[model samples]
Target: MTVVVNHHGVSAADVLTVARESATVSLSVDAIAAMTKSRSIVDSIERDGRPVYGISTGFGALANTFISPERRAELQHALIRSHAAGIGAPMPREVVRAMILLRIRSLALAHSGVRHIIVQALVDLLNHDITPWVPEHGSLGASGDLAPLAHCALVLMGEGWVLGKDGHRINGGDALMAAGLTPIELSSKEGLALINGTDGMLGMLILANDDLAHLCTMADVTAALSIEAMLGTDRPFHPSIHAIRPHPGQGLSAANIFRLLQNSAIMDSHRDDFEHAVQDAYSMRCAPQVAGAARDTLDFARGVAARELVSVADNPVVLPDGRVESTGNFHGAPLGFAADFLAIAACEIGSISERRVDRLLDVTRSRSLPPFLTPDAGVNSGLMIAQYTAAGIVAENRRLASPASVDTIPTSGMQEDHVSMGWAAAVKLRRVLDNLTSLLAVELLAAVRGLQLRAPLQPSPAGRIATEFVSLFAGRPGPDVFLAPILEHARATISGRDLRQALEAEVGPLA
Candidate 1:
């Protein structure tokens, strides 16, 4: 289905579909009208020789320097060329696509004083599968992701390179010509409008938010599997237990665990074991608290993402009454905060999962399960190293979760003294999200192996389905084989045929 961007603005979900699912994109009639009206205002400002901060005057510290009309277009050209200073690894294909889609959506708000053709060019780039080679570095998150967006803007100007449909590198001009598209001729303030916004970090935020939301849900699913494998109890997840501190995410996570473990012979087998401890370890018992809090953190992040989706993050906003104003809306502090918070939340989720993996590998702690779930514990070493892999990622996540927002160095000769290190925050959040995926996969494999060792006694109705689903690619209980293939299967389960989704089909959606 086609997604529309109008004067009223777009939503985060729409961006995801267009960016990730390859949905078709189009500009709204209202958006075209808004852009036309806003563009006319800029023309009038230039005609009247109004010293608009970004229109007729220089940018940043040189805001007082005015440019003549004849030189205005060159100003834009020079602005994009100079600001496209990003140098590092190219951004992920999905992220670049998202950046383009988001920049278009924000422009669709009709406050950036850009022509409709410019927005349409971005749409055509996406429709034609033309992705610019945007770099991974160079954005302060203030002045609206200037460096990252500039690289994107460079493609629109036909001055840079792009990755084609075949994933081959091609010059931006050549790509545009091949797709029957043409480069943009920047107007007064057009370059600034194109490059000034939180699209870079916002794009990453959207992707991370979507991934982390699913990860948080899957985190619960794996935790349930681990709990059962460890002979842990689900009583702590009862609604009555969570009633006093009722966080929506917590309740949802608890309810999910409670339902997933229903009718489990493994849990029931130890239900009346007087010799067994009444409570389980914190890693097993506090699953809901950690996973639910991650869910809640994402809830807040989504709110911010939604706001950014509909916002006009241009440096100087254009109003309907033909007024141009400089504003700080382009700062990415909100997104930076969301990204950092998600990193911390994802880190904690992985941290707990690693603990569960360690317990499963230890013979004494794993109940009756074989050591490392391997037939020959000492000779094979089993999943002993898997825990170490997970632990390594967990420690890296701690560093990724260091809150990039807390520290900022002055840039632009301190003209932008207090910058929001939001771009860094968003970038690291993606890494944290990736690391969490692998970490969760490692835990899933361990838990599935533990459940397999408990064979004769079946898992819960829900657990049985989850285990069976993973077992297809996981193979049966035995000595270690190619662990990468096993982990790949686990990652695919959570990413594609999600264990939670399978349970939801039978028992309904979890929290």
Candidate 2:
């Protein structure tokens, strides 16, 4: 199905499909008309002889310089050439695609004063799968994502590198011609319009939201598995027990645990036993509250992304009243804060899961389970170092959670003195999500083994689904096999939703 950029907004679901699932994209008719109308205003301004910030005049530190109409197009091209200064490894292909897609969506607002043809060229680029080689670094995220967006604009001018559908890097000019697309000659304000906005950081923020959403649900599922594996009771998850505090997430999590334990001989075995611990640890007991907080944060981030999708975050915005004026709508502080908050949330979710992993591995803590969940604790170290791996990843997540928005260095002769380091925040959040995926995998790996040792005693039906899913990678646990493959498979199963679906099909959907 095609995702339409109606110039009103795009949904987070639409962004994920186009960015990662190769979904088709198109512009709306009204958006095309708006661009044409805005383009006329720019042309009128050029004739009126006023030194518009990006039309008849220069950019950033050179904002005071005026350009003759004859030289205006050259000014635009030169601006793009000088600003495409990003340095580092190429950004992931999906991210580059998102950057292009979002840039087009913003331009569709017609506030950037870009010609409809330029917007169409960008659409054609995406339609033909001509991904620009935007660098991983080089965006302050205020004054728009200037450097990275400039790199993209450079390709439209047929002056940079692009990755073709065949996965080979080729000259941008050649790639454009190969795809039957032509280079664009930027008119007054087009270059600034192209480079100025928070598209890059916003793109990453949307994708991270998608990842963290599913990961939060899996966090609950895995925690439930761990509870049954250790022979812990699910009584603390009772609605009556959680209703006093009444956090929506807590109640939802408690309900989830109660439902997931359906028809379980293991939980049932403990139902009558007065000997079980009076309560589960905070990680198991409060799983929903922590994961729920992340859910609340995701809701906020999605709201921000939705607004960004429709809002005209351009410099020198074109208005329907026949006026074009420079504005500060390009700042990315909102996206920056969202990215940083989600990073912290992901880190905490992983941090708590790592603690659970350690608990399952410790004989003293694991109660009846064998040490490290290994059959012979002495002969096999089993998952001892696996917990270390999880701990190390959790440590890295703590570092990634450091807010990138708090720090800034001035650029453009102090013209852009207080920039948002939102690109940095977005990138770090992606890493935190990846690490969380791995951390959860390690905990599930240990939990699966713990359940195996419980044998003749069965886990809840929901837990059996989890164990069954992991069993595809982790069979009956004995001594450690090649551990990396198991971990990889486990991470994939969780990230890919196979683990969640396996359980949900039986116990119904989780919160």
What's the TM-score of every candidate structure?
0.97, 0.97
RMSD of each: 1.4, 1.4
Once superposed on the true structure, which residue ranges of model 1 sit more than 4 Å away at CA? 165-168
Clashes of each: 0, 1
Tens digits of per-residue lDDT for model 2, 146-229: 999998999999989887656666899998898888999988888888989999999999999889988888888788888888
The per-residue C-alpha lDDT of model 1 at residue 371 equals 80
lDDT, candidate 1, 3-84, per-residue tens: 8888887788887888888888998888898899989998898878878898999999888898888999999999999999
Q: What TM-score does structure 1 among the candidates reach?
A: 0.97
Candidate 2 structure, TM-score to reference: 0.97
